[model samples]
Each structure stands twice: as C-alpha cells, then as structure tokens.
Target: MRISFSKREHDLLERIRSGDEKAMERIYNEYRNEFIGWGVENHSISEQDALDHYQDTITIFFEKVMNGTLQEIESSVKTYLFGIGKNRILQQFQKENTRLRHEEGVHEHYRFLAEKELNDIYTSAIEKTAGMFSLLGEKCKEILKLFYFDKKSMTEIASVMNFKSEGVARTSKKRCLEKIREEMTKERNGG
Candidate 1:
C-alpha cells in the first residue's frame, strides 16, 4: 500500500537531505528507544543487539536521505525505520544460523574422523587376534572354533569336543581367551 508522507514528515526528510544534523538527530532520538523496545519484544532480539541494529537502521536511513535515494515515503518514518530494523535482525539471524551450521559441519567432520580411527583400531585388534589364533594348539583352536564360529552352546561344545562336562568347555574357553590376552599384552610390550 502506497501511503504519502505527512507534510511534517516530508519537511523532516527534506531537512535531513539538506544536511540538517539537528533534524537527523531528532529522528534518531525519537525512534531509537521505540525501535529497540519493539525489536526486543517483537523480534526476540536482545537489548544490545536491538540497540546495534537500531543504530545501523538509522545510519541506513540517513545514508538514503543524503544520497537522494529516499526522496519520498510510502509509510511513516517510524515504519520505515522499523522495517529496516526487522531486515537487519533477520540478516543477523541468518548469519547466526550459517555460523551454527558451519560449526555443526566441523563437529560432524571430527566425529567421522574419530569413528574411522576407532574402526581402524578395532580392525587392527581383530587382525592381531586372528594372528594369535594361529599360535594356539589344535585342541584350543577346535574349542574356540566350536564356541565362536560354530555358535555352539557349552553343552554342545562339550559333546562335540569330548569334554567331561559343560564346565570343562567353559573353562577351556576362558583359558583360550586368557592365552590370547597374554599374547596380545606381550606383543604390545615389544616382547
């Protein structure tokens, strides 16, 4: 909607355009608090941010007036200033959102790196454990293969391995794991 400026507002703009510093100051002073309050209440902007945007808004208004770009107004000066202030707040929010996204991207990159490193460590440990498996006696190897790769219960393992009982199968599995751990520790200590 195109609304013509009031005579007084038109005169104020003309005076500002003519380098009338007092007229500019009057406009600035008149709108500063109101703009800040409106920004804080309506836009959820903090007081300090509202004040900064208000200053920027006034500067933009003054610049337009001086540059002959703001010759006429379709709204009240307060509306114009508030419009500028709202745009500034939106720009600020966009900037903040962009920064937050960048930070999240950085964090995601680091998380990926950490996950890859952890997977590498786990892969290396599995490779080392496979190598250690080769050093086991045939009986221990058969017992571990039955319990793990064959997915056998302790009763089934004992029956297949000809152990006396499930307890013997459990003991054998425990001993196999302990031997692997001992060998791994020795390799780590450069033994």
Candidate 2:
C-alpha cells in the first residue's frame, strides 16, 4: 500500500528542497531517531551503525532533492526515509554479511533499490570533487578560482596572481589539480 503525506509534511518537504536549514533540521529530528530504532530492531545493526545509516540516508536525500534530481514524493517523507534507511541497512548487511534475519522479500527489494540509489549518490559526490581546487594552497586557490570560477584565461590568472609567465601559472594549476585529486581520493577512501 502507498503512503500519503499530510499537507504540513508536504510543506516541510518543499521547505527542505528550498534549502531551509530549520525545515531540514525538523525533518531530521522527526525521522532520524525512529529510523535508527527501526534499523536496530529489524536489521541487527548496532546503535552507532543505525545512527550512521540514518545520517547518510538523510544526507543523500538532501543532496538529491537540493540538486533537483529527486523532484517530488508520492509517499510521506517518513515513508521515504524508512525506505532509504531500509536500503542503507541492507547495504551494510551485504558488506558485513551479518547474520541478521530480515524478511526475505522486503530485504531483496530494498537491497536492489538501495544499490542503485546509493550508486547515483556516490557518482554525484565524486563529480562534486571537481571543485576542490578551491581548497588548495592560497596561491593555487586564487589562480584556480580566477581561472574556473571567475572565468579567467591562463594569462589573466597569471597576471592576477602576479606570476612571471602564463606557463608557470599553467603548471602550478596542473600540479594543484593533481594534489586536489589525491586529496579527494584520500577523503573518499576515509584515509
């Protein structure tokens, strides 16, 4: 059976989509603990594991909705959260091979859906790293910010950063980018 959201919940979802932090906080508070409890009871996940899954599910939901990928929900936000939480728990189960007895039918369905959804979230997250040049050393940061965010050419960036030549600026940018990629990979792998 399909679940429905009340008008207030629907409004809250809209607020979350619009980047209202308070609405997002309210949504998190309303569902996070309940989902954690559900995860612990049904999936045999530790309390900490349940909390991590809950936070990750909420983060994924927020990212998708804010990025305009997940437009609207037919289910109440609570039901949607539970669905995401179920999938996250199944993912943990598959990875850990914990001997937990979940209802086979529901587990199978959620596992399939969660794998796809999490893959999309992961992809989007990786793509977001292309902007990491902004976090490099101050000189590199300024040069890259001017080149990318400010739409400056190599010549312009060199002049802005007071480099001797465009070649030097270009090489610095390349090395900085490599450093950013290394950092991003380290972050993704939790190093």
Q: Per-prediction count of colliding residue pairs?
A: 0, 0
Query: Each model's TM-score, in the order given?
Result: 0.48, 0.51
Off by over 4 Å in 2: 1-4, 93-191
Q: Which window of ten consecutive residues has the lowest lDDT sum in model 1? A: 93-102
The runs of at least 3 residues in candidate 1 whose Cα sits more than 4 Å from the true structure, single-residue gaps closed, are: 93-191
Give a tens-digit lDDT track for model 1, residues 37-150: 898999897899888888878987897877666888789898888888788798784345533454466557666535776656544555566787877889889888776654
lDDT of each: 0.80, 0.73
Residue 121, candidate 1: Cα error in Å is 54
Error in Å for residue 132 of model 2: 2.5
